[model samples]
Target: MRYLKRHRHVGDPLEAALADTALGCGFARPVQHEVLAGMAAQVPEFAGGRKRALAHAVFTMLGADLAHDDFGPDAFDVDALHPWAAVQVTAAKAVLGRAAGKAPLGAGDLALLASTQRQGIVWEGNFFIHLLVLHALADVPGMQATVDEGLGTALMYQRDDGGMPFVTDTDTWSTVTAGLALHATGAPPPVLHRVARHLLRVQHKDGGWSYTDRAQLPDTDCTTVALEFLHQLDPYAYRGPIRRGLDALLAVRGSDGGFPTYGAGTPSEACMTAAAVNALSTQGHLHHGIIQSALHFLVGSQLADGSFPPGWSRSRLHTLFRAHLAGNHSFRTPPPPIRSMHEQTLSLVRAAQRADGGFGQQDGSPSDAISTSYGLIILTGQADPAPAARATRYLLAQLRPHGGTPSPPDMLGPRPFPYDVPVLADAFALLALGHLSRRIRPCRAAVPGRRHSGSRPVETDRAQHHDAGAAHSTENTT
Candidate 1:
């Protein structure tokens, strides 16, 4: 059965197809990789302490996105790492560590490894890259354990009917992500077989996968994930499905070569285009006419700041807060971001670079770890230490020594409540600290298990600021 039947849409078929496709994708990849590769090349040691940590984050995001495409959302969320996910990360690290026969793995090592499982604050896709990095950084034993656990989870989640549930039957995005997670974690062939059977049947006739199993009503994002997952599972196994999916994806691309979130004449979407390129390339379909056009489209659309605009439209949290306060709580869907031609994508990212040495989420968004980390990954796999250092200082300043991170009053812009500091933020902060520590002598000496020689934990008075929900305690020693 199809995940989202075409009948469910009241909008034009083209609109439904495009919108559905967009939801299945996120921040585009060619842009992300281009930025990351540049940063890595610029930095001599991409995998060294801080750089390594940042690389871990980049990969983590990619892994999380890809795996979520394979598994479902329930498997992991962005704000907090699930205990089960941690076990899987830990297990994968353990097994991999043994494979390498390295020294005993440490907590930082596991954290570093686990960080690769990317679930941003919203549990959006992009957590699998973290798992991949976790495997890369983990000792053989640790890596092996991680892989085993991931595989086991994939097996446990498999349905008797062969298809994986997207959380609980209605989530095609979840199904695709869960499937990818299983593959990325290296599920056994038998399990792969069951999933493959299911994906094929569920795939839309138009060469894509969507909320429902149907024809011409597929989404680009979900299709991208499915294509990549199948490529990883067994390249030749779903060749037909892959071919059709790519074609449908290509059909949806605008004249600018970028794919829009919805129908023809829709604006180009940076994120969707990036994801489309990555998915197509991963599936060995990069040479396709549509794929080539997409690549050119993205390169043309590059921002001067070295970052893409929100593929969907930008949202002002301040505006949202005010609306909520006024009791006009209706959620409005922003229009799709305009897709750019090849040269534009490159120019956009170049333009988006902040003087502070990071990419902002959007032109006016705050320069926090979340945006910086994302920008760094796109511009350079290694996060720029400058922005990271600043963010680190800001994060530390927010810590009350006794409680959660809070937004200072002066920083408010209509939204006065404390912003939620996501798990990814904490992960990024720890990573930045780790990187900065390596550059400074005293800080460098303060690796895990080592006490600060001269500094002592200082006593501070508690403040009355509201907590940012489960304010992730800087509990793990910085």
Candidate 2:
């Protein structure tokens, strides 16, 4: 509470929480030191390689440094540069050079330039992309003007309360994710309270939430996250919303007993199902019939390599970790079926580990920060600390000077969309480190009702019956 008074930045409190927890838990290992040393030595190489690659592409395509105007008239030829030349030049010399061009600019050329610049920074059509592009193009002169304009445009999407939506007019998903991340970091009470109120206010009449308040159709993924966040904050206070959300989760169950991301007709997905199980377990719905069926689905869905099929993320590690967490929470006594599933999942994750002590999205892929983080989270509470130790090392190696981690490009959706959000990578790394360190404490201030009890309120028989009925109905229909 005292720390809350001093910090106001959206992510600062969470970062501090993680740092403090890691320090208190003594999560650092000897292996991590060696990894850090090696990474320090490799930093110049990595930075140099990136600089070279970026410079080569930029120079080859644009000719003459956009940073400088040393290139002659031929280099700035609008005809030769046709499409590219149309892009707004930010450097003083480049602007002047373009202005001095004799050929009148065509509308198509201008349009092409505008689109290219937008794509370069805002390709995904999200405000966050604009911020990333601003950081990426910070050194390019004249680009500042474009960045400033883009920033204004991006700001237009911001909600009145200053929270940013992934896109304009949709705040639930982003808010929930940010709140959860902040909660994991031990964010201050007021900040979390604000987030909680927003989520509660946006809860749909059907007892679930979608990606946005505008999208009235409840999805399993967002609803699960919302329920989990509320449960963590104050289960008793939020019992009403929690019950409604649980029912909504049950309503979307596939005939196979697994939960789907969207509506009933949609197929069950590994990630969504895992999320459902975790959320349900959080609220003491672990033994419900629907959960049992979901567990069966998860076991049946495991690939030969021990990985689950990908859903939300391209990284198998993502689904594997989620499923592993689900199993850990869903099973009270570690039944044979769940235990076997856990072993197989752990083996696959361990196998995916690289010699560098990090994990990849899958076997044969290069190790990355996000996947490595997921691996650490999965292995942290297990019997062997070695895998988690190695993963912590791998993560330490990826930390940037500004305290963020950069992961390689990854797939976001069914399409080939590359999700290169560095900030998200940082958040996941912090979460892994927090779990690995075992320093994260429950938020007593945020959820004072359970602060003294330290026990989750039990689910009522009525809730269990409703869940069973929903599960049975889904099975009959499908």
Candidate 3:
């Protein structure tokens, strides 16, 4: 791994990717802000950086999407990104709007970086917001103190290269995901064992996990995926933590029989419910009672076309496929309706495949590694292998000597704007490839000297999934 990283030459993508995963224990020095930095720099005097249309392409794409989303003016659906993206866009435009005197000066008008702290992020979690806050507050009065603090927080995520990631401290989240991908392919290294053991040590008292070790708050999404990793690492060894995690997950169930991204009393979300059912049902008899209701909630929430309600993921297939796999662990025989939804979802996946054999966030959108990975995960083990095989080849073609491609961001952060978690694309590709390998040649993983738990990967609260998750094992992804 050191040889390739230092020598800088073409290498086998999978070997290089897995080597990267193992050495880092699955963490990546995450990056984002092509669009955002462009906007921030465009703020005229933004930290003395000049304006550039760095986000021109994405702006065009998102703008085209707004026409379909109705720009959400008459009504805003929080789940569908109505006002969230609108808020960011408004703040983004205010950078230039301020110059033409077109920007609104009212406090509500600026809506800058929202002082509201979602439980998902620590003050340090989202550095991009602090930078945008500076852009929005560029000329506002009585805000010097806030600006100073915001700049300090923003700089925390800055790299020596002078670019900053949208978020940081995703170490725990990245570790589990990278571990799962490697585990799916084969036994993970002892380094991952060390990392997972630490995860166990930090498991919240209530049996949940936050995205980072630095966070005090634990959400259902991270908790469930963490449990999946623990179980896959070694069910018996981590039984105590897994059980506590299950209890924590159940504690957060909404009245509708679904789970939410965060804790109890939050509204049940489609992807979260699906993930809860997947992780809970995997352990056999123990969680069937819980799974039934959550599965019901998820199925009821499904769109007529077989996709579940959209949340954190940009692609419908991301949650749709994970929900499909999660429901497979149905109590006894699957109910006719539940079985039918799985079939329907599978059909949708088949339908959504592009001519290139890869899948995209939407049927006609350009293909990307992240969404394609989710598609392959669901398509694997189907009666037909053609789709999954083709997708696999397409994915491999996209991988670079450095082990990544320019996959579009599928996850939403702080609501609607896409935030890149670069490792996810690689992790999921590894996961999908593993699934395809297993489907074609059904080889057993030789249990190594070390322990591992988990029957699978997981899906997200949104544009996220593990083959074993398609994954938060539903919806806001890590």
Query: lDDT winner among the candidates?
Result: 3
Error of 1 at 279 (Å): 2.5
Worst 10 residues of 3 by lDDT: 61-70
Q: Order the candidates by lDDT, highest first — what do you get?
A: 3, 2, 1
- Model 1 per-residue lDDT tens digits across residues 235-349: 7867777788778777777888877654444556655676666565554334556655665565555445433443321221111111111111110221122222212332444
Off by over 4 Å in 2: 1-171, 285-287, 439-478
lDDT tens per residue, model 2, 8-55: 332322223323333343223343334233222321221322222322
Q: List candidate 3 stretches off by more than 4 Å.
A: 1-124, 129-143, 160-162, 442-478
lDDT score of residue 430 within candidate 2 = 74
Error of 3 at 224 (Å): 1.0
Backbone clash pairs for candidate 2 read 90-142
Model 3, 214-237: lDDT tens digits are 665677667777777777777888
For residue 319, model 1's alpha carbon misses the true position, in angstroms, by 23
Each candidate's lDDT (Cα)?
0.43, 0.59, 0.62
